[model samples]
Target: MTVTASARAASPLLDLVRPARPTHVVDVGANPIDGDPPYRGMLAAGLCRVTGFEPQPDALDELKRRKGPHETYLPDALGDGGTHTLHVAATSGMTSLFRPDTNRLGLFNGFSEWGRVREEVQISTRRLDDVEEVDAFDLLKIDIQGAELMVFEGGRRKLAEAVAVHTEVSFVPLYENQPVFGDVDQELRGQGFIPHAFAAVKRWPIAPVVFGGDFRQARHQLLEADVVYVRDFGHPESMTDEQLKQLALVAHHVYDSTDLAYHCLSQLSLRGLAVPDAPNRFLAVLGSANRT
Candidate 1:
């Protein structure tokens, strides 16, 4: 008997059964090009789905055109279903629901250009729960400038189904009345997620001019970072077999969490959901990557 290609591809982390439900990823405030969304990587691994929400019409058109067979792009903002003003910045990355603090912007070099508001456009938003398509997901990636809390507030129903999360966090408030990392940490903790890893740590020094005004050299201030949160990390045995697989995938590719992925494999092995040799293969791959 010949071994099928997909069955050959199946492993403890990802089982390539022909019709097994694809892992789902939901992205809010998604700019496909700018932030290098991790969901893109997951989707490329095959047998996965990605749904991205970007309010900007121009970006939405391009996203729609580039969407894959298992990917979707929605031209709507994620929020609590109400009207809000989007402060469009001279530098598009700074666009957000909250206004930039001019006083704070003036203190930083080149940051004034980043925070300079080019336009203000009033737009209505809706909760992710309002959309029937978002029934459940394995991972949720959000990057909506400083409105991370609002996205979670509106998508609480969908969020409950998520096993892991990756979102941008600010150590200090860049926008007026924006909640800092503390609020986001508390919120995710309340929702049953534990901080697992930190990525893209950005720092801004209090006095940049001292070191030739190059903020990169001055790592005095922790400005922003992307944090990875996992559900049921303390108790992997609590997760379903499918959830374990999803967590393993994200941890392996995005977080480089070899141990956590191994733990998930071990749990799956105990439940007989995965092959006995999965953990060994996983460790070997991790070791190979580290060597290079």
Candidate 2:
């Protein structure tokens, strides 16, 4: 499936933009039932059959303990879908599907900059293409830190099998010398995926204001949230160009304040830029909007 720029402008995620509802979802980097994993919002949305993959011992355990019949927990990393050495951070749960390096930390604003604690583990990897006769996915969310590119490469078959994808595209290099946005963008586009870059929030105060009184702070455009890739299936193409522009405008406007800011900052920081507001609040808004 391929997402068009027109569809991205107006729709929520690519899955939401499609004419049909997404029933099946695969959430990678799912927040642990005990510790923080990732993508808690997707689970709350009541997706049918979720398969979460985590490499951290504690987080993986929590995932297993909480996984019901509708959910499956895997302790392996999604690599080029084969056996590969995983660099388990001294912090454990911060395991990277690819080798750890300093450049990636730059993209994430030093989030994983603990400088690789002296501990390491050899974890197995699985390629999505290796799996036989798997069901189609409605939505696939991946946030494997710097390992996103590897997973995509291994999941080429699966990528074609899915309708929509929500991936964390960090321009940060996983290793000292690895390609980032430019490479992934080309790869995804080549695979017939339309990519939507998440936006960032603009600076605005949070003080409550009276509705019809003297409201000084009307919500202005803040940020872009997630870059969604939609396949060409199920999108309405007969809309006017003006309608498409409006749709894109509204879609960008919908990202939550803080989360959008965080996404924006993550993208910009790679180039050594700063966001105008509180990073926490910025990420929070985008996170909330993605939920909505």
Candidate 3:
């Protein structure tokens, strides 16, 4: 599942239409356990720079060891800048600030074993706004198990300038007092971000029920998913020309949302802000990529 930048088709149009500066990305809870990130293509093309935060010692070590020149990794646990207990689970990916809800996890198969608490470590968190290393960024990608709301509440100032957000949203709360999808969605909307798409949708089968000889196969229970949100594209007049261009680059390079990228370019073109025929050139490049 390690997707490299080479997997994507080459497009010279991206080179011509990319922003003057590299897109800045801030990644919270950046554990490589999830495989390659969505911005891998941009990173490989030298079109973006990443600043990642990981609290776990082993995970932080791995990130630093393999980081690129433009990539920076910090060992800061990000939240509302308060002290909290980190519930280390049997599986690293399951570790979270909030304790696991064993009763609820038992309702689904495989999760109970994965979410079992192995240890608890007291730690201090740093608010995103307080981090001096992160001055400003164009995109934010966060996945901190269940404490996503705390970051949003404390990082409003930093998030205001971001063009897009890629965050993990839970349909069902696996941790005690965890905020679900609706909670995160409302907060992002209040911050002027609109839901764009769901990059991943995870489902788990109910316990003690086997479906078609596959015990791990899910029948109809939604667990969690990675959701992408972007600043209101419908009102291009409200956004700056730089914001529009950055959004187009993010949409095309990160999410492969060609239509959305084209719409962004189209708005810039109408205002005489973009290069001549930028939208059409984008479509042509996409068409050629698809054919190859």
Candidate 4:
């Protein structure tokens, strides 16, 4: 059996199962053409429109080269309103908005070997408080390496504006002075975001994890898979059963390997759908179909 191929492959059955889930997303740490081409097809489905921000010159250029309709690009880092120079990492993937020591804390050490250590390059920053308007956002992904907190601090108002948040978290110290998971989680919760779900580490959907939990085992990883958070949106406990199921489906994809219960509970805020009585019924159907 094969994974069902659909227009929205990361979430296929979801649209058919429940077509109302918000698809507009904002990607914070979009690296050029790196990992997942961050916002490509989402724009195609008429379910997306995104503002992708990246600080590295090369990556920013690549983002420009690869952009299309419904997508906008910003060459600034997301943080409090100010100007700051970033210590650009030698390599593209390694390039971050922070100091080099932080790279050493991540699970991958390849950046340490790339070797070019340079002075801070001037970059403009923005605070979310300064953001006068954000119409709506279904999802907001923040992967700005170790400076995620700075972005979070600046985007306090925008955080409240979004429906869900996806930020990468490294349990170990990847940067010399970056906050740990505890700090990040507290910051998220402070802004009314809850740890909605988890996604495992993978370059793409095609690359499966053959080993056990990398986040649980990797020594100094830059980021484990992205951690997702959902906004309470003033009605934390209000959701239809179908919306709950749809959310569970997303949770399954996010933390694809984790238990089903978490996958189900994560969709606590979905708007219009019925809650199926026996949650496992749909799971059993999908599971049995996969075996065929």
Which portions of model 4 show Cα errors greater than 4 Å? 1-22, 32-34, 37-41, 102-109, 132-134, 202-225, 232-292
User: Cα miss at 194, model 3 (Å)?
Assistant: 0.6
The C-alpha TM-scores of every prediction are: 0.88, 0.56, 0.93, 0.66
The candidate scoring highest on TM-score is 3
lDDT of each structure?
Answer: 0.76, 0.51, 0.87, 0.57
Better of 2 and 3 by lDDT: 3
Cand. 1 Cα-lDDT: 0.76
Residue 53 error, candidate 1, Å: 0.5
- Over the full model, what C-alpha lDDT does candidate 3 score relative to the true structure? 0.87
The order by descending TM-score is 3, 1, 4, 2
Better model by lDDT, 1 or 4? 1
Q: Write the per-residue lDDT of candidate 2 for residues 121-228, one digit (tens) a residue.
A: 566677766655335555577766566677778787767656456766554354554546677677777666676545322222223433345433435422112366
Model 4 vs. true fold: TM: 0.66
Ranking by lDDT: 3, 1, 4, 2
Cα deviation in Å at residue 254, candidate 3?
0.9
Model 3 worst lDDT window (10 residues): 1-10
Tens-digit lDDT track for model 3 on 60-87? Answer: 9999999987799999999989999999
Please tell me which model should have the higher lDDT, number 1 or number 3. Answer: 3
Q: 1-292, model 1: which lDDT tens digit per residue?
A: 1223552263334541112356778888777656567665656656467888899887788778877777788888888788999999987788899999987776665678788998999999888889776767888888888888987877777777778989899987888999899999999998889998886787775633646655546546787898989986777756666777777776766666879888877777777777787788777755675698
